[model samples]
Structure formats: structure tokens, C-alpha cells
Target: MDFENFLKKLKEKDRVTLSKVITLVDNETKEGVEFLKKFYKERKDSFRIGITGPPGVGKSTLLNKLIERFAKKYDSVSVVAVDPSSPFTGGAILGDRLRMENIYKFDNVYMRSVASRGSLGGLSSSTENILQVLEIFGTDVIFVETVGVGQSELDVMEITDLVIVTLVPESGDSIQAMKAGIMEIGDIFVINKSDREDAYRVSEYVKSILQMKYQDKELTPPVINVSAKNDTNIDELVSRIENLKEIFIQKGIIERKREIRRKKEVREILRDMFIKSIDRELKIIENKNDKDVSPYEISEKILKNIDFKSLEDIWKER
Candidate 1:
């Protein structure tokens, strides 16, 4: 279908059209790039919340509960759940949707499962672009659920407005090891499965760490204990999220985050374009079979020949 017709159907809330648009954007097709160029300018604002933690931390369960609560209050809510991709097949099971089966009943809720595609940062390369499409589709709130991440995998912080680090009682020691990494990125800490033994102890441990880390700062990350399986304390969690959103807006933190996101996105786009241009040059050099010159020398030749001015003109045309 043409872009105009697809957009018209999107405004009419066609799920099929929405799914197709997301696929196009995720694949980064020529049409998808054109669609985003137009839609991004006309996109509405949506508060993006990122939930990230280690494997088997009940992140999906907590997210399901949060989505249920938000769907009641917002006109539209969406989810981007990233699952680990298989190295051999380049495919994902996308099992997060199975765990969040209940959310399927809500007509105002849209959920898409994405493969991490071997990304070390726990996010797909196209994640930010897919988010832009979701915003253009008129969601009020968007939840980004990352694949089980290690300490160094923190790409979520670059794109999200708020980051919630979910933990279980068993995460106490892990938190100590990750204090400088994932722990520092959280705006809120959640201890899921609070019905288990030592849940409060873990929560207090997390609180103490936050206190020491943010002692001089005006705002400290709040730690909450909840049993997502039992639906306990979900209301409090939602309330805290709402309050934090207000606080972030008042402090201009969200706008600053968006500014940084824009700059990073521009750099990534330029880098990708440069890599493609270099590959084109390399192909021509390969056909010539210059066995006498080393790889480094060929790279220097390509670098020297590159017209930086033309790159700026190309960006302007885009």
C-alpha cells in the first residue's frame, strides 16, 4: 500500500497496518525511511519507560501489571519487548508475549516483540526507529522491556525517559557488584516477588546503596518491593512512576534526555552512512586487486578521497 493510505488506516487504528509499518521500520526499508521522515515530524509525545534487569527477574510480569494499570488511564499504551536472538538462526522465541498474555485482551494496548539481533547492549539496532513509529501511532505511554542484560549492557538509558531496574531477593550481591554500572542508571528500583523470604532485606540493601550514591543529589531513586505474581503493591509502583514523571518534567530532565538522544541518533546515522560509503569504495579497490598495498594504506587512500562537504550536503537533502 501507499504511504498515505497506510497512514490513513493507521489513524483509523488498524492493527494490521500498524504491524506492517513497524515491520517496515524495523527492517529499515527505503519506504520505511521515507515514512519515518514524514511521521517523525508529526509524531505526538509519549512517555517512554524502560524496564531492564538480569535474566529471570520477573521483568515481564511486572511490566504486564504496569501495562494493565496504564491502559486504564491512558488512551493508548504500547510495549516493545526485546528478546534474545539465536546466534545460529537469527530468530527469537519472543516468549515475553506468552507471559503477558492478559494484555492481549485490551484493545487500546499494542505490543511488539523484537529480537535483540546479537546486540551486546540488549537493544535492537532499529529499536529507536520503531519507537518513533509507535509515538506517531498516538500512544500516550510506551514501555520498553529489554532482554536480560549484564552490567555493561545499558543502551536503554540513552533512549528512555525513566529507567526501572527490577530485581529479586537473590539480587542483593549482584547489586553490590553492579553498583557502578546498571545500578547507577536506574531512576527507580523494584524488588519483584516480594512475597519471598528476605525481600525486605534486599530492598533495604538497595535503598542503602542509593542513599550513599545519591546523598549529595536532590533526588534519590526510590526502591519499592512488590509481588507481581500476586498483584501486590502495583498501585504504589504506578503512583511512584507517575510522581517521578511529574518530577522529571518539572526538573527539565526529560527534555535534556531527549536532546542527548537526538544528538546520539544523528551521530549513529552519520556513522552508518559513512560505513556504507567506505564499503562502496572498498569494493572498487578490491576489483583492482592491489596486492602491493596494505589494508591500512588503502584505508588511508579512501579517507583522503572522501568529501566531507558532500556528506553534509547529503544530510541536508535528507
Candidate 2:
């Protein structure tokens, strides 16, 4: 089907078209860029949740349980699972779905695995764009699972309304989560694999850290213990998520968060366009006759000759 038909079917909740649209956006072809340039009305109230943490913390399993719980309350749910990319080929194994096989059986749940593609923030380059499409497609609740790259995955914050950072008992993740950047971003912390002996200890550790970090603040993130495999406390986790949504609404923080996200998206789009425009100059500098040119010097030269309007025009054309 053509782009228009695909978009029409996507709005009609056609799963096949939704999957194709994600792929088209990922491809970043001229057609895909054109489609992205088309504006779609935003759904202001849809819940966007982010789940992130270290690998082996059972983020996928936790998400599966969350999907089951969310499905009971919402008619449609979508997931963007960001998996690590292959360093050699820049391709993704897309293995998050392997553990979430049962979730695929739910017609209301639409899951897409995205390769991180060397993005520093643990999300794919096209994640925000794909999320815009999903929002326009009328998904009631959207969940984003990051590449599990630890603290630096804050890019998830740009798109998700609530960020849930998952940690396991034995992985030293509890302490790691308390480190500078990571602890502050979490709206909720989940100690998964709660069946483990040290689960409560980890939960307490997280809670204490939060208490210390936010003692002066009005809103402190809640810590919950749950076993994704055993389905323990999953309902409580979902309840916390729902409650947080209300808090965000009552405090009018949602609008501020959306504003921040809009600014971030605009900055990213401009950065990408600038980098694309500089590609030829960068290549020329790389093949320069003077091998002694420093990286900083080449960068300075590129910026000295960069044309802002030309780059803007190129971006517009794309």
C-alpha cells in the first residue's frame, strides 16, 4: 500500500500498517521524511510510560506483565522495545519480543522492537517520530522500553510521561540506580525478581536513596517490589502508574513536561539536519592532504563555512 493508504489503515488500527509505518520511519528515506513532516493532531491525555534499567533485570518480563494489566483498562496499547544493535553490521537482533511471545497474542497490544542503532540515550534515532505516529494512531497507552544501557538512557524521558527504572536484587543495580543522573529521572522504581532473597533489601535501598534525594521536594518517586515471572505486585505497580498520572494532571506538570519534550525534539531535529549537512565537509576534511590537521581544527573549519539557511532549506526539502 502507498503512504496515504498505510496511514489510513494505521488510523483504522491495522496492525500490519502500523508495523510498516515504524519500518518506514526507521528507514529515514525521502518518503519517510516527507511522511514525518506531515503534522498529526496530538492526543494530549494518552499515557506514555518509559521502562529502563540495566540488562538482565527482566525489563521485558516486567513490561509483559504491565501490558496485561494495562490491557484490562485501556482498549489499545503499544510498545517500543529498544534493543541493542549489532556493532559490526548496525543491525538489531530484535530479541526483546522473544521473551514477550505471549503478549503478541493480545490483539490490543502492538509491540515493536527498535534497534538502538548506536544512539547514546538507549533509544533509537527515530523513536520520537515513531511515537508521534503511534500517538496519532490512537493508542491509549504507549510503553517505551530502552536499550538497558544504564544511566545515560535519559532520552526515554523526552517521550515518556512516567519513567519506571527497573532493577534486580543481586545485580548491584540498586546502588547503581542511586548514582547521579539515574535516580532523579525515575517516577517509579521497580525491584523486579522480588522472589529473590535480597529483594526487600534492594527495595529499601532504593527507597532510602529516594528519601534522601527528594526529602525537600513535594513529589517523591515510589518504590515497588514485584516478581515479573511470578506476577507479584504487578497490580500495585499499575496502580502506582495510574495514580501518578492523576498527580501529574492535578499539578499541571504534564503540560510543562510536554513543553520540555517539544523543545528537546526540535533541538534533536536541528542537530540531525546540521550533521547531515556537514557530512560532505567532514568527509573532505578526513581526506585532506594535510594529515596533521587536528580534529578540533577540522571542526572549526566546518563551522566557519557552514551555511545555516542552506541547511534549513535542505532539511525542508528532505
Candidate 3:
């Protein structure tokens, strides 16, 4: 479709349109990449929630229930399910693909599933692009569910307004949470599948971990318990998320989040531009090389000859 028509479609449609926009952004085409740069500058707000844990922590189930609540109250939601499981000759298993089918009927809930594909951070690098598209689409709430994340990917925090870690009882996750790593990133800790034997113990473990690791900050993350299958404590979980938003407002976290999002969009535009420039220049050099130029020889020339300062200046322009 033409750019104006596409823009109209994007502003009007649901998650499906957002999904298409992300796919276009991922393509790195001349028009596609340029459109995203403009689109990102135009779209500025989406309340992001990150639901992450190991594979079977009931995140999908909880998110399904959570979406039900959002649908009733909000205009729309954007969900990105990042499934990092090994491929069946390369395919997502039960994690993002099949699990999300539980909430597929909700018209207001727009879902996109992304195979993790050995992404090092337990999240795709292009996730920011997907999120920007959703923000432009006017989704009131955006949820990104990672199959898992390690200590390294604070990148998830870069885009999230709230980071909610979902855990089940007796999963050895308590110790994992306490190791001076994941605890700091959590805005909310959820003990899902609380019907299990050590559920309360897990809750206590989370509380203990928080008590041990908290800084002098007044807004400490809360440990919430919920059983998604039975729909127990679901309302409280919803309230807790709202509570986090209120806290965000009070603590100026909303502004902090906005600043981060602005920087992210700017960087993404520059990165995509550099990629295109590098690709095109290398191809031109290769076409000109009649003799057998070594790959390193051409690569070094490309690196040495390109005006990085000019590229940087281009990025700085509005």
C-alpha cells in the first residue's frame, strides 16, 4: 500500500495492523525503514508491561486473565509474545504460539507472537520496533512476555513502564530472584499458580528477597499472589498494576519512562539508517571491484571511508 494509505490504516486498525507495521519495520527497506522513523516520532505513549519468567511459570495464563480485565476497561491493548523455545525444524512450541490461543477471542486484545530464535537476552532485538508500532497504534496497554530473561538484558527495562516477574512456587525461582540481580528490575512480583503447595512460601520468599535487597527508595515493588486458572486474586493483580501506574505518576517515573522511550526511538532511526547505508555502500564497492578483493579488504574500506560524523549529524536532525 501507499504510505499515506498505510498511515491511515495503521491509525485506524487493531493489533493486526500493528503487527503488519512491525513486520514492515523489520524488513529494513528504504520506504519501510523511513516510515518507521517518522512513525516513531509521531507516536509517543504506551504503558508497557513486561511479564517474564522461565518457560512454565503460568505467565500466559495470567496474561490471558489480565487481558480480560484490560478489554473491559481500556480501549485496546498490544501484546507481544516472545517465545524462545527451540524450533521444530525451527518453530515456537507451547510457549507463545499455543498458550496465547486462550485469549484469542477478545477483539480488543491484539496479540503478536515472535519466536525468540536464540536471542541472547531472551527477547528479540527488534522488540523495540514492535513496541513503537503499537504505541503509534494507540494501544492503552502493551504487554511483552519473554520466555525468560537473564541478568544481562536490562534492555527489557529500557522499554517497560513496569516490569512484572511471574513465578510459581517451588521452582527454585526464589533464589534466582534474590541473587542481587532480577529483584532490582521488578516493579511487581507475582506468584502465579498460587494453588500449589509452596505458593505462600514463594510469596514469603519474594517478600524476604525484597526486604533484603531493597534500596532506600520509598516505592518498593509488591509481591502479589494469583491463580489464573481459577481466576482467584485476578482483580487484586489488576489493582496492583494500576497501583504501580499511580506510583509511577507520583515518583515521576512516567516522565522517566517517556524520556527513555524518546531516546530509544531516536537511536532506532539512526541504527536502521546506518544499516541501510552500510549495506548499500558495500554493494557499490563490491560491484566496482573487478579483481578478487578480499572480504576484509572491502569491509575495511567501507569502515574507513564512511563519514560517521555526517551520519551522526543526520540522526540528530528532527
Top candidate (TM-score):
1
The C-alpha RMSD of each candidate to the native structure, in angstroms, is 2.7, 2.4, 4.9
Best lDDT among the predictions, by candidate number: 1
Global Cα lDDT for candidate 3 = 0.74
Models 1 onward score TM values of: 0.92, 0.90, 0.80
lDDT-based ranking:
1, 2, 3
Ranking by TM-score: 1, 2, 3
Encode model 1's per-residue lDDT on 1-318: one tens digit a residue: 488888888888888999999999888777788899877876887999999988898999999899889999999999999887887888778888877965887889999999878565478878999999888888899999985466224688887999999999999888878787878889989999999999999999898888988864647999999999999999999999999999999999999999999999999887877766666667779789689989899889888898887755554454
Report backbone clashes per prediction. 0, 0, 1
Q: Indicate the residue-level lDDT of 121 in model 1.
A: 41
- The C-alpha lDDT values of all candidates are 0.86, 0.80, 0.74
lDDT of 2 by residue, 44-159 (tens): 35679999887788999999888888887789988988877777888667888877865767889988878878775477788887887788678999999985565345788778
Q: Report residue 199 deviation for candidate 1 (angstroms).
A: 1.0
Clashing pairs in 3: 87-91
Question: How far off is residue 311 in model 3, in Å?
Answer: 7.2
Worst 10 residues of 3 by lDDT: 87-96
